[model samples]
Target chain A: MSGGSGTRNTNTEPWGSFDDHLIQGSGAAVIDMENMDDTSGSSFEDMGEMHQRMKEEEEVTAEAAATDDDTHDDGEFLGMKGLKGQLGRQVADEVWQAGKRQASRAFNLYANIDILRPYFDVEPVQVRSRLIESLIPVRMINFPQKIAGELYGPLMLVFTLVAILLHGMKTSDTVIREGTLMGTAIGTCFGYWLGVSSFIYFLAYLVNAQITMLQMLSLLGYGLFGHCVVLLITYNIHFHFLFYVLWLLIGGLSTLRMVAALLSRTVGQTPRLLLCGTLSLLHMLFLLYLHFNYHKIVEGLLDSLDGPHMAPMQRVARDVAELTLNASVRSLGVTLRAQ
Target chain B: PDWFHWTRTSFTEASRPFAGLSDVSISEDIPVEGDISVPVGSSRRDEEFSTLDEPVKETILRDLRAVGNKFIHVLYPKRSSALLRDWDLWGPLLLCVTLALLLQGGAADNDDQGGPQFAEVFVIVWFGSIIITLNSKLLGGTISFFQSLCVLGYCIMPLTVAMIVCRLVLLGSSGTVSFAVRLIVVTASFGWSTFASTAFLADSQPPNRKALVVYPVFLFYFVIGWMVLTFSPSQ
Candidate 1:
């Protein structure tokens, strides 16, 4: 409670960023001490008193910064300054070093104290409640902002490509091939998007705002790396659905981690418990839908792919087909020749 | 009469334990040093009781009274109840099932069709679920499985409406106009899905600062994933 009010004022200042409060509070505390001593006595008498008081205050401040207790370093101070003129420069250097060390220690102490002070004044229970309330806005704002910046950007690109591919397929006269390619592209895009998005959202839900955008991106990279691993596994196993499910599981696990962190930070257990229950219900439905509809969708796609269409070489279709086929064949031939 | 009966009954219940005690014999429990014996439940017995000594007795009685008060308070009826009174587990389950069914059904209907009708529907529902679920999970509220499914349903409703609008717009439009519209539609799907993917990852497992380097990597992979899925023979 020594500088409690001053600290509170600093903390409550409008738009008081972290550095602002630290610098302001420390400076104010020192200045308040200096002013109190200056106003206490007569000019000449006070001059001598002021000098001593200033020295005492400086020492106290330095000590407080170094350690809350002020007893240990008195001898070192006396030794450094006792024969002042004899080694004035040396003494000055020592003082300078002491100042640097003291300043750093003070900074460290201040940061620790500020973070811990909230716990002392507010019960852990109360702080937790506030933290949960605070989380709502933090989640809302952070979720959309991060997703818009990170997730949406890549999604846009993928959709564009898919659209182009679809357009190419639609124009193709080779009914079965066009249908098959189109179906595959559509299905794959659908599956990939579903898997990736689910995974990404899950990842987003797990992290805290203390995390920087860069860190989030990197974690996302890890998720994609996870995706790559899944893809490799899927390729080896030759099970598409498994791969999709695995991608989702990874996403879900990642999201669960974020959810856990958020829950840990949250004050009440009730809301989180409810939320989890709700998610479970939704998950079961999604699973059920996937189970029931997967075959029918696949069948529909196959039928569409096999439906009657123009001949194999409509002008636009011919151009794209030739280009893609040639490029792929060329790559294959090069690979074979290399082998 | 009601008040008297209730009070008498309560008092009787409270006093029953004390009434059951019979003999208090010091000599039977321990050999008496001299001839000092105390009678049980006598007026003089209060002074003989060690616990009845002024300071000690006061402390013991105070503690017992406090415990009895606490017990009585606990037995009192509660004042308020929870908001979710009629909530049932099956309701949420059914909603979730419905959403999943819609998604699967739409996908089936639209598959391999040159038209974007059902694909649009499936993507909308699927992506909507992803976004809503991610948000709900991150927010840490009592989001029931059914609530999430409902949210998924609600989120996709707009997309479904948009698809209908798109069809209407394309009816009288030129071929190039149609192409552009389709392009826009597909782009939106990809973009939204990609965003969902990244968001899902970001929200799920938060990486350290160094993980920002992975943004491009994720993007690259996302594109690759999209390509593979789109072009794979199985699809």
Candidate 2:
């Protein structure tokens, strides 16, 4: 207790007359040192009281100095003295200010949509040509130096697939909501895109291949467009057997395109082939997953279309084919139904 | 040095009033073998709460009881700190794995591969919680990192239950009725999770910034609930 008083007395000697006037004007609370000594030997009360006195003194001086010639000095005094109150409060204030600044800085990045336009900008002709280019097994002629990927195309492809799938499913008498179908489609589509792109990016990095994430994203995105086209055709046909055949044919073609893109950037022979094979396998697995889960064969394909140019035997054959197809699809659905 | 001494003195001052009372009670009634009536955050270690020569089974049982108590606290959430005071990750890990496994099973039932869906659910739950915890910490919440995580994870119990109920509903039949039933269950559980987590966490956050801390919690549970609601065993 005596030591606490001694330190306070020593620390206060450095203050000038202005500080003394400020302390005196605040209250006699600062001058009442005897009351503190009678409390306890613990220095906690002493320090808390000292901080309380300093805070009052600064507040009083701040008002007086604001009207006088020491405004700038009092501002600095307030800033420095306010910090000595509570550690947790001070830390919270500092963190809140820093976070506010960081949030604003981050929000500014999206303020200008033009900055994001680079990822979305493409002509209709460009999209058509790119979709056609993706359909080809390989692009040997006029291959660009770097593959330019766009998120807009991939996102549109996903949206289109979700739209067509919902339409086809609804036409087939399946009662599902748009949001549910859209969520599943977007989750599976982008999940595969992001997962496979990161996988390929990691493999490329391992082999020291010079490729950017955008290239992998664009490659996979375009590959997905091929699958999306297959879905569209199958939707039109609504034939289970035809859908399978198209899935295999177009799935293989898209895999080839992805391999060609990867092989062009890589150097080594064995690693290139291994990477290509693994990637193609993964791509096929994703396609198969979609085939089983997402490929809903809308019924009445034969009923909806009329082949006017067919002979009598051909028409009879078409009727028989539709009968068998509808029967088999029904049996499969019944067997797969939950018990 | 002054701050350290000040904190210690304040702590001692706060406990002084209760010291004599506790001492008198201790002399009157000694706690039994399984008595866990020791007040939390006391100066003594957990081992000293009971006898030192306790059997292994008793210790395990005590720990299990503590975990169960936390689950009950989450189920019936009030403005209590029991969840925060005895925080553990075991319950959260269990809930996360169970939910992920149930989701994976749902996919597998459709003759689809189960690995990706399991990993997807696992990553979403864990990654989402970590992001929420980081946000809370960055917002100057007074809670400890693991404490917030524990609350978030334990609150997932309701959603995990909802997922189980959803899977069972999917088993009965899938149509608009089943979908409606699953939707109601998921929505109710999602609300329960959000309320329970915020109840445990609200006190630790700054008064003005409670909404900031809660918005992320709301989003985190909403995403999980969306996954649960949209999950179809057939698909």
Candidate 3:
């Protein structure tokens, strides 16, 4: 009981007014940047200047709203010059804001997984919501913030790598020395992420999707988070095909969700559809490869990534034995069986 | 016009409470405190807001000198965030002892393999923690190295429970029933440890670095969870 009382109580919570401060900070920064831009500006002016302008505009807008009674439109930005550029700037600004939250959600979202499905459905603000943490990564026209998502992707890679490393370590104590086992597992985890991310990036680029390479890396990283779950559990458990399949199904769904979230709406609808469809099939194949070729691939990677353990003479001698002595032994056994 | 419609949907939901007000009236709702219309955004200076200014307690406890107190802290992580600082190793040490004891029971090798199995598991867990610590450091995380280990080591509590269940299943069940027990226990613990540890490590990373650190910590636990699931007493 005393131990309960002993926990170091903090005077201030770790995060104080963090959410509000972040919003305020971002607004200030956005306004500053917008005002500074000669063109491609997202908002109107300097803080002091903007406040005065807003006050004047508020009266004009109030009168307009009352007279026109058009709830959605009390147009002012529209009547100003260069409408296309203005719209582009606005979209760029909103996307910047939405992406920050999206990126965080991509990482922290599943830490509360009892109701992943319902969580996405409940926050129906954008198409981004529909795809995040969901199984279907349908190509939407937006992406989340990059830096956290970028770092988060690497974390997933590390998770997958750690899973493979520990699995190898688990076997080393159980079975043979497997000197190269850890190295191979490490290489495989790294290679899988790099290869898959590159492949997806290529697909996205082919379709002219607004998906960035960094976002793709994050998606791959997060996608592998689910796979790491699958590998950690299944690889350790013995030969339970059903359990493996079920975990794969769930992991695939999440990966698909990331794929959808990564695809920018700038992508043509046709190629975006093709890319998602292709990636889905590719993911299934990848799972099958993991399942069926698990041992074979590990062994091959061990040989490749493990570097040279045996001396060249030792390898040559073994090859000679297989060619001459083993062949002779096989023939003798066949002849004896015939007799 | 097309772009306006898109932005409207994306942002309008948050602005809905003001929809009924005229534009001038809505602007008038800007909160005032002292001389300024403060840029608090969603924050309000309401008296009912819970204050976090409590008496600060040092996470390190003098009671940690006693092994019993250490064990108690191990069982109850929040009782003392000793792991949050450098004052205790008991939490990880006790968790390991309990884990080894649990794993030792119903083990296939039983007595001879007991010490080795426990050592292997302990080493793997600690080593995995180091991987995460290093990754966080690489990403410019602010959490102290030992603090990372403490969060990771304490997270073993859930997996230890799973190990206890494994020992129980070994004692009382066989065949299909045994497999079912193992699966359920490991999965639940896997979920708990992954989520719990993430909560601790989540804020430590520069928000940019979370993907790198959090994901690996998650995978490391997954590996531990797998060991618990696959464990069977030797024939």
| Runs with alpha carbons beyond 4 Å of true place in candidate 1 | A1-339, B1-142, B178-235
Each candidate structure's count of clashing pairs: 49, 0, 11
Model 1 Cα lDDT, one tens digit per residue, A2-87: 23123222122222223423544443322111121111112333334344445545666775565523224544566665655435
For residues B1-235, write the lDDT of model 1, one tens digit per residue. 3433343333233224223224332335545343322333345554676564469778868656644442222223122111021122332233333433333322123344433432443453445344434333322222333333332232222233334444455555635456456446644544443343333233222243213322332333233223222221122
Which window of 10 residues has the lowest lDDT sum in candidate 1 chain A? Answer: A32-41
- Cα deviation in Å at residue B25, candidate 3? 33
lDDT of 2 by residue, A1-339 (tens): 221221332122222222332333443213223232221222443456566545544554554554454435445566676644444544665576557545544543222333444665555557667777777766652343356777555655554554445444433334323334445655667778888889989988888766788888888888887677776565445566777787778888888887887777777888787778888999887766554445332112222332544222111121123422332155554555533
Candidate 3 local Cα displacement, residue A318, angstroms = 31
Error of 3 at A153 (Å): 5.6
Per-residue alpha-carbon lDDT of candidate 3 for residues A232-331, written as tens digits (9 for 90 to 100): 5554443355445755677767756765565443356678677777666766666555544555555455456547783221111211212222221445
**Interface root-mean-square deviation (Å) of every model:** 28.4, 20.2, 18.8
What stretches of model 2 exceed 4 Å from their correct place?
A1-339, B1-47, B50-52, B108-112
Whose lDDT is higher: candidate 1's or candidate 3's? 3
**Model 1 residue A164 lDDT score:** 37
Q: How far does residue A219 in candidate 3 sit from its true spot (Å)?
A: 3.8
Q: fnat, candidate 2? A: 0.00
If both were scored by TM-score, which would come out higher, candidate 2 or candidate 3?
3
TM-score of 1: 0.23
Candidate 3 CAPRI-style tier: incorrect
If scored against the real structure, what TM-score would every candidate get?
0.23, 0.38, 0.42
